[model samples]
Target: MSTEKVRAYQPETKPKRKQKQVKVKVTKKKWISTGEKYLYSVISGAMLCACAYVISFSSATDSLNRDIESMEGKIQEQQSVNNSLSYEAEQLRNPERILEIAKKHGLDIKQSQVKQAGTVSAD
Candidate 1:
């Protein structure tokens, strides 16, 4: 057996230090959630597309109307030209005018042989 010293058990104590108080800042919460924000964005985009479609349709309709009006104006002008040409042709086909032109050309045509030709009707 070896000779050994036996130590007594004693409790250790430490000095207390002052602790500083930590402040926690509270953040404000957003009224709209992320999911709600995405839903609103999709809805607004759809509405915008709908509005654009309506406006474009209206513009196309207006353009077609203008084109129709232009064609109508052209038809009216052509009808006026046709009317004037028909009147001039009628003037040229007059019996007196034909006789005068024949006389000017030194053709001695008898009045009895100068029969006035009438128009043939299909009906």
Candidate 2:
């Protein structure tokens, strides 16, 4: 039994592995040759350009809106000025005001002077 146990218990030996130097081959890639990569770059550039154009257009639209608002305000102000000027013109066209202005300008018309001026004088 001891001999059978000794024969069954043969010492274990580890297998030796050989180490070799491995060379890895790396390939150089051209900038335009890879289809998917080039396509991705082109699509990305197009997306960026589209975004920039949208941003610029939005900014221009905002500027135009602001200008429109400014013009509207100016138009309102001008309308108010025109209303006041029209009121002033109506007041100036009043006969009493015209008489006062003529008096201030040293132009006086007596009733006799009007009648004398109305009569035609034959020379």
Q: Return the TM-score for each candidate structure.
A: 0.63, 0.58
Computed on alpha carbons, the lDDT of every model, listed in order, comes to 0.88, 0.83
Q: Looking at model 1, which ten-residue stretch has the lowest summed lDDT?
A: 1-10
Global CA lDDT computed for model 2? 0.83
- Residues 1-123, candidate 1: write the lDDT tens digits: 233322233344577798998999999899999999999999999999999999999999999999999999999999999999999999998888998999899988765566666878788
TM-score of predicted structure 1: 0.63
Model 2 lDDT-worst window of ten: 111-120
lDDT of 2 by residue, 78-99 (tens): 9999999999977866776666
Residue pairs with backbone atoms closer than 3 Å in model 2 (clashes): none
